[model samples]
Every structure is written in structure tokens, then in C-alpha cells.
Target: MEKPAELQAANYDLVARDTKSVGAYVKSGAPYVWVTAAAISVAFIITVALLLLTAARGLPHFWPADLVQATYKEPGKEQQHLLAEIRSSEEVTTARLLNAGLPVDEKQPLYDRLLLKIANRDLGGVDFRYVLSDWLVERSQPKDATVLERMEWGNFHGFVVALKEGDKVVASGEEAWKGYQERQDRVNDLRGKVRDIEKGKIGAVNYDLERLRLQQRRLELDGKTPERNAADFAAIEAKRKSENEKYEVLRTELDQLNAEMGRDALVMKTVDGQEVTLPLSKLIQGYRPNDMGLFPKIGFFLGAIWHFVSEEPREANTEGGIFPAIFGTVMMVMIMSVIVTPFGILAALYLREYAKQGPLTQAIRIAVNNLAGVPSIVFGMFGLGFFVYFVGANIDKALYQEGLPSPTFGTPGILWASLTLALLTLPVVIVATEEGLARIPRSIREASLALGATKAETLWKVVLPMASPAMMTGLILAIARAAGEVAPLMLVGVVKLAPSLPLDGNVPFVHFERKFMHLGFHIYDVGFQSPNVEAARPLVYATAFLLVLVILLLNLSAIRIRNKLRERYKALEH
Candidate 1:
């Protein structure tokens, strides 16, 4: 062996070399850089995958898949014709089948079963059924099979028997299809006219009547007696009568249109061989999905998507489009952003720019940070108590005493929902704005002051302009949180269904006091509360996808605005 000193020196040299290598690695920051990059990349991949999965499930809901007509017969059961769409399929164990009291072949360890959407809720108590794959003796997609998307009682799947005008047979076979199509076009046009008159003309007139009543009450409160305001009341009364006369004419036209649409009916035969006499006006759409070519299917798919996005929901939001939900979500987010930004920015300005730096200021900053983590539902409760019950009831008592007992603003509504969300997101905005103000170089403020600008002027012009991006960043975060927040909205304003949109032909153009549908609430309602879970499954996925899409869009809009602002103030940084 070598001398002890020489051996010790060699060990020290090796240890020093290793330490130097580690130090160099730490100085380069490669480990942290790689870790950060990996985290970001993984997050991106997960987000993209989640989005793709949502699309795969949700987008297919609109596609016109060919309905399968299968003949199912088990050992002891009679043969049956299954005329329905195969919604899904799964492999089930024989043991599980036995437990459910289903007939199972002992020879087979597993069996395939299909979840079928056998629509025609009027005829069948159940809309979905599970049939063993092995039990289906034969299956076919008949070109003559037709499906009708009705206004009520869900979808009707069958074959067209004949076209009838009153009790007279107008056409049969090929000509019947043509006649039905033509008649359907007329019915659609008539329906549109009725909707316009009912919602636009009549609704606007009703709004004015309510306003006139409020006006009369106001006149009374001001001590302007009937004699003094006789001309005003007379003018109002004249307008009201004129509008009523117009409404009566529209109602007459609507009655005539309904009669015209009711004149024709289609004799449709159900899958179980029951003949259904369906009115032309009751059917929203009738199509043969089995016979549709690729282009036609694409067209049908596009039309389905359009209807889903444009039309009002029906059947407890299990069927039809979610246009109102979409509109409410967007409008509420916009209102919330508007309400939060000014208040948040002002609070931040006062704290950072004007308030003295002390332990008290430090405590406030800490408290604001802590507020960001508070449960959203708590804010909703506060809003309901403070905004709806207290503020709104007082406003009702003061402004519209005539409308007392029937509280106008003393309820959950769009305004309350928006305000609640604003409160929930306020801390985020405040923190972000404060950080943004802090980021402005002291030299910039000094330079502005040197130029004889007031403290407020420097903040208003120089500091705030540069802080715009941060405000947007805060807004982006706020929207990301608020748009998907179902818990707070539930207590604040969202309803399972709304008869009319918050925005309509009503006065003020928007009804802030009205309850509205939200996509998040729609998802929750359809997924949990709907009587038909299997029927509502597709809608749940679709609504979830739409909610995500809406949030993404809101964030993108804010980001675009922020980028433009950043570009405008880019020179200030230099």
C-alpha cells in the first residue's frame, strides 16, 4: 500500500473535482431549466389530450350514425325487432349477467351487449335498452326507415306511411316524401312568423305596459295627481291601446298560421308497428339517416350542430341547443370583468401608490392574498344576503313601492351572478395589479415627477399603461375561474331552464333581474337531475365541451386586447 498522506491527498483531490463539477452544473441551472420545461410540456400535452378526448366524444353526438334494425331472440323470449341506434357497446361478464337476472349462456365466459337508443318516448316508457350482441340474429340498415325530431316527447323513429291533407290521402310512396318536405318547409316558415310576433311584438308591448305602470306610480309619488298628469296618462293609455291592437292582429295571424300548419298530418308507423298520426308543425326535422350519403350526412351533422348552438333547449336540457346558456355565460363574464377591473385597480392604486408602507399595509396585502383562496360558495351566500335581500329589497321599497311584495330585484339574477363572481375574483385582480404597479421602475415615476407631472398623472399615464398586460392577465385568470364555477352560480342565479333569454326584445335590451341558463349548470342538471340518464349522456359531454370552449374564447379575447395594449406601450419599457 502507498503512504497514508499520499492516499488522503488523492481522496481530497477526487472529492474537490466532484464538488467543482456539481457547482458548475448548479451555476448553469440546467437541472431547473429542464425541470421547468418538462413541467410545461407535460401540462401542454395533458391539456391537448383532454381537449381531443372531449371533442371525440362530444362532436360525434351530432353525427348522423346509421340506425341499426336488429332482430333479437333469446332462449325463452320471443323474437323481437330492434329498430334503434346502437349508442354504445360493452363486454359484460356472464357472472354479472346472472346477477342482473339476464339469460346467459354457460358456455361463454363473457358476452357483448349494446346500449340502444330506441327513441319514440311517447310509445315506450323507456328510451334506452341493452340487448345481448349474440341474441341479435340479424341486422340491417333500411333506406326507407325515417326518424323525426319532434318538438315534444323526444325523437320518433319509424317509417313514413302516407301524407294526408285533412282526411284525404294526398300522396303515397316516393311522392309522399316530396309532399312532406314541401309541407314541412311551409310549417317552418309559419312557426318562425309566430315566434317573431309572440316574442318581439307582444313581448316589447308587455314591457312598455310594465314601464307605464311604473311611470304612473312615479307620478303619484311626486304628488302629480291624475288631473295634472292627465295628458301624460292619456298619451300612455293611447300608446298602450295602439300596441294592444297591434298585438291582437298578430295573435289573429298566429291563430291562422297554426290552423294552416294543423291542416296537414303524416301517418308514421313506429318500430313496433303502431301507426302515429303526427302533425307537420310538431316535427322540427324528419330524415332518413340510414340512406344519407357522406355529403348529406355532413350537411345533417352541421345542421345538428347549428341547432345545438342556436336553438333553445328542451326536455330538461336533455335535447336541443343551448343558445341561451351560451349567451348568458358570455354576457355574465363580460359584466363581471367590467365590474371587477375598475374596483380592483382602484384598490391596488390606493394601497401601492398612496398608502403608507407599514405593518398594517403588509397585513392587508397578506389578507388579500388569503382572500384568493376562500371558497366561492361563501361569496355567493354573501351576495345573496347583501345584494339580493338587503340592497334589492331596499331598492324595491324606495324606487318601485307599487311593485312591493312582488320583489323585482330581491332575487337571484344575472346582475347578482355577475357581481358575486366579481367579488370572488377581486383578490386575484388586486394582487396582479399591485404586482404590475410594483414592476414599474422607480426611475419612471421619478422621471415623470421631474417633468412636473403630478403623482396621479404619472400613475394614470405612465404606470397604468404599462400595467395593462397584467390587468389582462388577472382578467384571464379570473375568467378561467369564473366561467367553470358552477357552485357559486347555483346560489347566485343559474336555473335548470329559463323560458326566455335574459337578453330579448324587452326594454333596456337586457334583463339583469331575470334568471338565466349557464352551460356549467346545464351540464350539472343534465348529468345529475335528468330523468333519462342514458339519453342525456351525450348532452352532458357536449355541454362540458361547450363550457370549455366558451372559457377559452373569453380568455383569447382578453389576451388579444392585452397584446394590443402591450404593443402600444412597448416603447415605454425602453
Candidate 2:
């Protein structure tokens, strides 16, 4: 009966329109291709838009904006003279405005409020203030207003009342401004010298002294008592005494510089008539933005940007540049790439060139591909358990027993962080390298075999050189992934504030056992954990921008290497 029905349908010799349409769509594959392309286009557009927004928000933080002088009259209080920078403005519902005790008109649906950076932190007790739009009776960028970037108390916004040398007023009016600028430069120079003497020379001596202590401990351990290593102890003692003398000289000079710097102070008057006397040593910079010429403004912008890039972070990392974070991130990523490449390439070679074509080999390949999909946090946990607690702790016990109470390698550090990242990105490298090797024709191997080349030699010379572009591809992917990873790094090595960089003049020079700051972690700390949310807001955008830039630069470098290798082996690839 079924045969009869099939025969009857065949006899009709008519194609169903829906069936034909479905067949045509499957054959062409246009729908799937278009959908994928559309998705990719949308993703690209979103990434570009986000980057633009970050740049708009972050890059302007370094620009020296003119200070605004506004008289804001509160309902119950008298007129408050506000000398601050109008950082930003946003519209909020009238309901929210009223909730904040502002007299918002009930008829108005929304009120525009200004974000003012009231930088007299010592007096105002806050770096930022939000003022009602309606309360502003006067708003002007006063010509004489000055903004002082400080070493402490965040920043100061006021008029230059006078320049004081101790109890006497050395300069006032126009002369005071000029004198303050000149004196500020001298103080900055003195601070630089102090920093050098303390962190460079004195720091090196301290490091050496610690090493000597370790040496003494090691000597004691080698024997049983101090008397057994008496000569070694005497030599170490002499070295320590010499180092201490050098340190004392630096300390005396530092004291002299500090005394000289503290002699001059700036007498600044706020718009409210409250005067703040800041020592020239505490002031990083002073600028009258409202009166700056175009060239001067450009100079100030450039200087500010440079300072952000070169200077150490301060004020809970909500202010100042992220130099240490930048350095650490780049160093960690570079180290990870170095460690992963050889290991990944070797594992890929063993599987591709020598392994038997069996179920086990196939299973291994599957496992590697699956590893790429594993959650990164899982890798972080694995790293903590295996690399740090197991391997690093053992290393510390074996080599640094003298530094025991404070675990050196046992603690989270740059080396462990890099290694953990290497493990996380290994699957990517293995998969890329395997694919590269698979693409190499069997005839190429045969040709090498025909030439009487050993299998190892042939693989190294022919397979590896040809596969280098793919290796670079894998490395680029690894860097892109690792550079932006805050979770794993936070677990492994990253910190909010690294007192010293991993690289310093300490013993072994590259102190990979030190905890370091990272750009991604810095962004996280500022955006979420910072106490001053308003002050930290712009910096969060800025740090995110920098992180993206670092990733882009790393990718570009790898791409450049890949392109070069591809060109060199183009004929072989063909």
C-alpha cells in the first residue's frame, strides 16, 4: 500500500513550492552567511562606539579647564561663593532634586545640575560637590583664579593672596603669582632630588643590607653557630657599616632639602574668604587656566598628559597617572608570551608530527579544544592551587627559608601570574599550531625525508618555520586575552598599590617574586572600590581607555610579526 502511494505521488511529476524553496535556500547558504556578517558588523560598530565614548570621557581629564566662580544661594543659608571647575552637567528628575533638599520647581519635570570639583579638600572635606542649577546667581571663569595641583589634599582652587617667606610677605598681587610659579619649580626640583636619593641610592643600599642579612642566616644554617662563620660575619658587618654611612649622608641631605623647601609658602584665598597657606613643597603645579593663551594651554595639556603617563599614582589612585600599572601589565604579558610559546609549540609538535593516529590522540585534541572554552576563573583557581601553593611554596621553602615569615615566592607574584596566564592561553596556541601543521602537505614531509633529513631536523626546519605565522596568531590571541584579565591576576599577583615595581636594583634585578599593579585591576579598583565615587569616575574611564590601548598595541605588534613570517614563507605555504 505504501509503494502504491509513493508511485502515485511520482506519477503526478509536480514539485511542491515550499519544498523547492527550502532546497534552494539550503543550496545557496546566503541566509547563514548574511546573518554572520550582520552580527560581526554590529559587534564592530558597538566596539568603536564604546571606545569613542571612553576617549571622550577620559582624555579630557588632562586638559586644563577654566575655573568657574559661581554664587550659589541655598534656601536656608547665605550666598556661598563657589570657586571650582564645572566638570560636567546632567539632567535629573525634579523628584530626585527635591529629595536632595534642593528647591526644584514642582512644575518642572527635570532639572539640570552641574558637577563642580570643589578642590579645597582640607577645608571643604570633599573634593567634589553637586550644586543646584537654579541657585546659581553668578557664573564666571574669573581671570585671577588659580588651580593648584598638589602633592597632598588633592587640589586647591583659589586666588593667589600672597607669597610668604616664613612670617614675612615676600610678594603679593602680580608679583606674588610670578614668585609662586618660580618657587614651585624650585620645590619640584628639590623633591625630584629627594626622591632619587631615597628611592635610588638609599633603596639600593637597603636591598643590599637585606641580602647581607640573608647571607648571614645562610652561613649560620650551613654551620651550627655564628662562631663557625665569624670571618663571613665580620665582612658582612663591615659592608653593612659602609652602606649605613652612605645612607646617613643621603638622609642628612634630604633633611636639608626638606627644611629649605618648607621655608616658602603660598597664601591662597578662596572665594568664600577662607585663606589656606600651602607650602611650596606640597604644590605640584599652579596654573591660571582662564588667562592662558592658546599655546600655553597646549603646553599645559601636554604637560598634564606627560605627568599622568610618567608619575606614580596617588590619592587612592583616583588621581595621578597609572605608570606602575602600565609597566606591570606590559611586563607580565610579555613574560607570559615568552613562557607559553615554546611549551605550546612543543606540545603541538609532539601531537601533530609524532603521535599515532589513534583514539587517544583524537581525545587529546578534543580536550585541548574544550580547554579553550573553560571559564578563566577556573584556570585562576587551578593556578592558585597548583602553581602558587604547590610549586611556589616549595621553591620558597627550598631557596628563601631566611625570608620565611614573609613568604617570597610562596605569595602571589608576577612570575606566578605570568605562568598562570600562560596556562590559560596554552589551549589557543596548541590549537592554532596544530591547524598550521595540519595544513602543511604530507609531500613536504616526504620531500624532507627524500633529502635524507632526520625526522626531527625536517620538522624543526620545515614545519616550524612555515607554522611561525600561526604561532604569532596564537600569541596575539593570548596577549589580547591575558592583558585584560583582572580576575586571574587578582587571584595570582595583582594589588591595589605595589610599593615598589617588580623591576628594581634589588638582588637578581628582575624581582618576579613581587606583587604588582595592573591596568585592568586599577580600572576595577577606581570604578567600584574607590571611596570617592565622583572623583574616581573620570579616572575609571581613563584607565579603561589605557587598557584597551595596551591590548591594541600588543595585538598590532604580534600582527606585524605574523605578517613578516607569512611573507617569508609564502612560497612554502603555497
Which has the greatest lDDT?
Answer: 2
lDDT of 2 by residue, 51-154 (tens): 99998998888888888898998788888889888899988999987887776688999877889998988888998988878887778888999999888778
Superposition TM-score, candidate 1 onto the true structure: 0.94
Q: What is the lDDT of residue 417 in candidate 1?
A: 94
Cα-based lDDT at residue 203, candidate 2 = 89
- Candidate 1 wrongly placed segments (more than 4 Å): 1-20, 216-237
Residue 542's lDDT in candidate 2: 82
lDDT of 2 at 462: 94
lDDT of each: 0.88, 0.89
